[model samples]
Target: MQAFTGSTLYAAIGGLHVGDMLVQLVFFIILLILVKKYAWGPIIGMMQKREEYVANEIEIAEQNRAEAERASKEAAEKLRQTKEDAQKIIEDAKHIGGKQEQEIIESARQEAERIKISAQEEIKTEKEKAIQALQDKVASLSVLIASKVIEKEINAEDQEKLIDEYIKEVGEER
Candidate 1:
């Protein structure tokens, strides 16, 4: 709305302070140079160190995961092997038990056989003694009958009575 004039625009912004503006500019340039020289390298070094630390941590995590997987696999394999060994031990125990059972049965059977043989031998010996006693009884009976008959003739009834008396005498003596 007003007439265009350079001086009036400059006066509105306080343009006579241009020398102060230049001094402020020079001060800003010096500040920037000082910050770049004194602070930038340490800040960059700190950032690089942080990056390397993070990368190392990630690599360690990966290695730990792999180690854990390998350990788990090894544990599983050991478990399988332990189970197999236990099975083998069970089988061996069963085999030993069976063998012992068989041995015990065989021993019992042999003992029974020995007992039977001993009993048979004893029976045979008893039978022979009984037969000998019978022969002796018969011989004594014959001799007594022959002597009685020679002394006096015996009828059938007398012969029967004599035999009964001899049997009684033999039984009492034994």
Candidate 2:
């Protein structure tokens, strides 16, 4: 009967043993807080710096993408402008060639007109000379015919008088 009462007393006192367990739990929590304060600050700072670096890299990549797009647009504009300039140059060349051709044609026409005028002048001069020669020949033939007719009709005394008058007219002309 006494052994049974001692066991019952032990069971009643078991609740008081939980006081030591609570003290142990409080000590563990204090140790955890001290370790976090000393060790965790640098780790968290390193993680924050890593995150900022990654964010900066993403920003740089985005900027590079925008720059590439701008360069591509500039290149396209340059190509288009070059093509337009080339077309304008070709048009200008064509216009200049056409103007030169027109000038050449006009020059050729003027030269031909001058040549035709020169040929006409030469022909007119030749015709005048031929007419003068024909007139001289006709005068000589008429003189010959008149001399023959005079020789057949005139008498000796009249021939002598006519000869003397011709000599007097020739001397006056000289």
User: Best candidate per lDDT, number?
Assistant: 1
Q: Mark the regions of model 2 whose C-alpha exceeds 4 Å error after superposition.
A: 1-35, 152-174
Cα lDDT tens digits for candidate 2, 32-148: 898789778888889999999999999999999999999999999999999999999999999999999999999999999999999999999999988887677657655854786
How many clashes show up in model 1?
A: 0
lDDT of 2: 0.84
Worst 10 residues of 1 by lDDT: 9-18
Q: Which stretches of candidate 1 lie over 4 Å from their true place?
A: 10-30
Choose the strongest candidate by TM-score. 1
Pairs of colliding residues, candidate 2: none
Taken over the whole model, the C-alpha lDDT of each candidate is 0.91, 0.84
- Scored by lDDT, model 1 comes in at 0.91
